[model samples]
Structures are given as structure tokens and as C-alpha cells.
Target: MFQRALICTDFTDSMYRLAQFVPSLAGGGFKSLVFFHNVSVESGREIPREDPELLEKPRQRLQALLREVPSNIDVTIDVQMGRASESILRLAKQHQSDVIFLGTPTRTMLEEKLFGSTTARLAEKTGTPLMILRPQLVSTYTTAELELRCNHLFRYLLVPYDGSDGGKTLIKKIHHQVKTNPNSVLERVRLLWVIDENVRRELLGDNPMEQAQQELDKLQSELAALNLVVNTTIVEGSPIEEILKTAEMHDVGAIAACSRSIGGILKWSAPSLTREILRGSWHPVLFFPN
Candidate 1:
């Protein structure tokens, strides 16, 4: 479970959309939320020291805005000067963060061909799970009696498991989260196992999908004992596609995925899947890296 989560920003409108997700993450018992923004300084560029007011003004406004977020959990804000992804990773290490939150904008293939996404880069560099939130869906915000106002934006959660060690690792974290949150508005969490067509064509000569379903059934039974209302889904298609469809169908708050670090034979990486899901789903994504 993530004890301290860092929300990385470039101090844009999209950053605010991502900030809204902190309440739900914190409501799940995360201890602290750190707001991080990076300012770039070129080698020959004029120094902020020459005209400090140019830098000081935005810094002050960011501090004020962060103060307004209603969270009993600890909140800290940091505005730095450096490369964006590098700065975020440094801060995560300095703070010992377990999760990083990012807001990704809808990008065209041409845009991705040129400028890569920051969230994607961070997801590859660290063990911390990076959560990428979509743009806000609700236009209005109503304050509740106590604590932060409910945005009612995301009420569902989708988790994809392949019956692998990595998948179970993610399930354990989610289980801990569920056990901790007794009052979370999250109504349902769906576990999905996709039978990739390519794998079926290669590995299971006759009935690969059936064998896969049997494994998923056992995994579902194990999850049922947790006593939380969990829904199960089994689909046959691309793994990323199936996961995204399930999330969209449920209007999920976010998708929590477990991924492994680069290893010997299994060079499978999740940054692509993370980017793919962010591109397809308007909901947020929570990534767990092994």
C-alpha cells in the first residue's frame, strides 16, 4: 500500500483535475499527499535570481491553492527547477513515496510521435505506482457537511489480473486498501482476466482459453473470501483493450494494475499498457510496479 503519494504537475488546468483524485486516495488511508511542480532552467537562460518576482508570484499562488484542498491527511507542496520527470522521481525518492499521480491529456498519434508523455517516462523509471487521471467529468462541486466535498466523479474501480505473481501483488495492495476504507464511496471493484488471442494461437493448441478460465475461477474464489463485493470478468481479446472496455463499461474511477520490472526472459513492460489505457479511458489509472 502507498503511504505517501506524490502528485506531479506542470501547474496547468490538467493538474487540478488530477488533484481532485487525492481525496479518494487519501480516503483510502494514504498518509500524505505531496504536490510537485517542476520549472525548467536552460543552461544559457536568464536566472530567476535576476528577477525573482517572475518565479515568486506563481509559487505563492500554487501554495495558496494547495492550502484550500480539504484533507485531514498531511499535504506538502514543492515547486522546483529542473527536468520534469527527473525532478518528480527525485522528490519521490526524497519523500519515500509509494505512488505518483499524473493527469494526462488526450494526445494525437502525431503528438506522441514527437513529444512523449511525462507519466509514461515516470512509470518506467520508478517502482512507485503512477496514477494518471483523465480530465474532470463533472462541472459542479458541492460541499458536504464534513471533510472534502464529494465530486461524485468516479464511483467504480477496475482491476486486471492474469493469475501471475504480479497480479496477486496488486490484489494484495487493493485488499489492504479495502480493509482500511470502511466508508469509501467506491461501490464496486471488478477483476478482469483477458485471454489474449495471440497467446491462444501460440500456447493452448486446443483449448487454451478454457484452461485460463479455470485458473481465473480459482483466483476469483480466493478473492471472494475477502468479503468485499467484487465482480469478475473474463474476456477474449487484447489484454489492454479488454481492460479498457471493462473500465468504460463500469464507469470506473480508475484501473489498478500490477506490473513487473524488466527481467531476464519476460521483458514485458507495462508503460505501453499504461499509456494505452490512459489514451482510451477517461478514468484514472493506478499502476503497481514489481
Candidate 2:
């Protein structure tokens, strides 16, 4: 339910790729979009202010491309100069953006290790849900495909649940995501309980499916009481794969998850399922800290 969205670009093919999702957003019933282009010097690099036109080139190109977007959705253009991540985050805060869409560059092994991910970094920094698009992924969806994708973007979303206090906290934040954003297209919630067989003998038992179903049913009842359509799924094998398959089957556009902070003996870090899903999911992810 986002009334306003901030879409950031870097004048790359991926940026235009991210733009394609805008029409998808409008189909999901968003009111307005802010298309932002940021010209940033590399982390340790400096900008030559003397050649102001060098900076202006990115903005000019971005504005020219905006004309290609379907005019049905209200759109505005913003040009800024700064660190890409910092500028995008600042604008989101300044505009009170309901959501932020970003483009992630496809990288090789060396690049990934050295460059990491601006999109992932931003997601960690801001609780704001991010839709990260890669050029190839974006091209797979045509106008028709996007229209179909948009239809149920929020209809069925998957949440990997633990049934812990942290899990409850995650759900509360997800409820906020559903309620706070005016243009959120969500209609249903699917609760998934990842059984840690290493920890729970019950999970390793011959008939753990029944137990998983019962757990899902319990959570379903809780969400249904909130007037949301709820779905339940029980899967075995890797937790992340199960979660991703659930999201794929349901055609979920986003995911809401909680991260357990890394600690002493526990050494809890961002959940592996969360990391795997983000790395592989076509959908955006919203992570809540526990």
C-alpha cells in the first residue's frame, strides 16, 4: 500500500530495467512515482566539479528516458549528485517514500566479492522494502507478463516463521508493511515453519509433515483473525529452498522476514534462508530486525 515510491537509477541498462517495474507497480495500484537518478563518485574517488556538464549528462539521459514510461501513473524526475546509496536513502527519507526500488548490477565472482551489493547494503540500512532488479530478470517479463505479475503481486506472500518471540515481532512488522503503505497490494499471508531437524527430533521424525501442517494452521488462524486470506505450506529439505519454492509457486512479489542478530555462542547472523532467498528471489524482500 505505497502511495509514493522512490525509484533510483544509475544510467545503466539495469536502471532502465528497474523502470520496467514501475508499470507493474501502477498496475498494483500505486498513485505516484518519483524517478531518481544519482551521479556518484566511487567510494574513494572524487568528482571534478569544474566540468559540471559531466554531472548533468546522467540527469539529462534519465529525463529523456522518462518520456518512454506510460503516462498513466503520475511521475516526477529528480536529479542529485552524491554517494549513490546515501543520496537514495536521503531522498527516500526526505520524501517519506513508502517503498524504494533499486537496480542491482549482475556481477562475477571477483566483482561480487570486491563490490558486494549496493542494493543489499541499502536493504540492511533501511527497513524500507526494496525491489532489486537485474537487467536479464527484468527483460523476462513483458508488458503482458508484468501485467499478470502485478495482478497478484501482493495476493500471496510467504513469511518464514519460527513461532518464537522474534517470529511474533516479525509478523507485527509485516502487519505494518501491509497496513502502513497505502498502495500495498497484499491480500494474503502464508506462514512457513522451517523445521530444524538438527535441533528438533520431531522434525526428523517419520511424520513431521503433520506437525508442520498443525503449526501452519495455528499461525493461519492468527493471521485470518486480522482479516487476511491465509495459506499454509509444509516443506522438507533445505529451509531456504523450501521458502523460495513456496514464494515461486505462490507468485509472491515480496517477502517479510526477521533477522536474528549475531551473538556469542549462538553467533546468530542474518538467517541463511533470508540470504539465499534474497540472492535468488525475483521478488523484493522486507527484513525486520529482531
The candidate scoring highest on TM-score is 2
Model 1 scores a C-alpha lDDT of 0.64
In model 2, the clashing pairs are 1-181, 1-182, 1-183, 1-184, 2-183, 2-184
Q: lDDT: which candidate is best?
A: 2
- For residues 1-290, what per-residue lDDT tens digits would candidate 1 score against the true structure? 35677877665635643344556546655668787777777746654543456556656766665534555778777777767788898999999886787767766555755777776566667777777665453223332411242233224568887776767788887766555655434456688888776663766447666776777677666656656457778788888878877877876667886654423112223345544565666556776665
Candidate 2 all-Cα RMSD: 4.1
Badly placed stretches (over 4 Å) of model 2 are 17-24, 47-52, 65-74, 105-112, 150-152, 181-183, 197-215, 262-271, 288-290
Give the range of the ten consecutive residues with the poorest summed lDDT in model 1. Answer: 262-271
Predicted candidate 2 versus true structure: per-residue lDDT over 242-288, tens digit per residue: 77777778767667766554221121133455555556655656555
Cα deviation of 112, candidate 2, in Å: 4.3
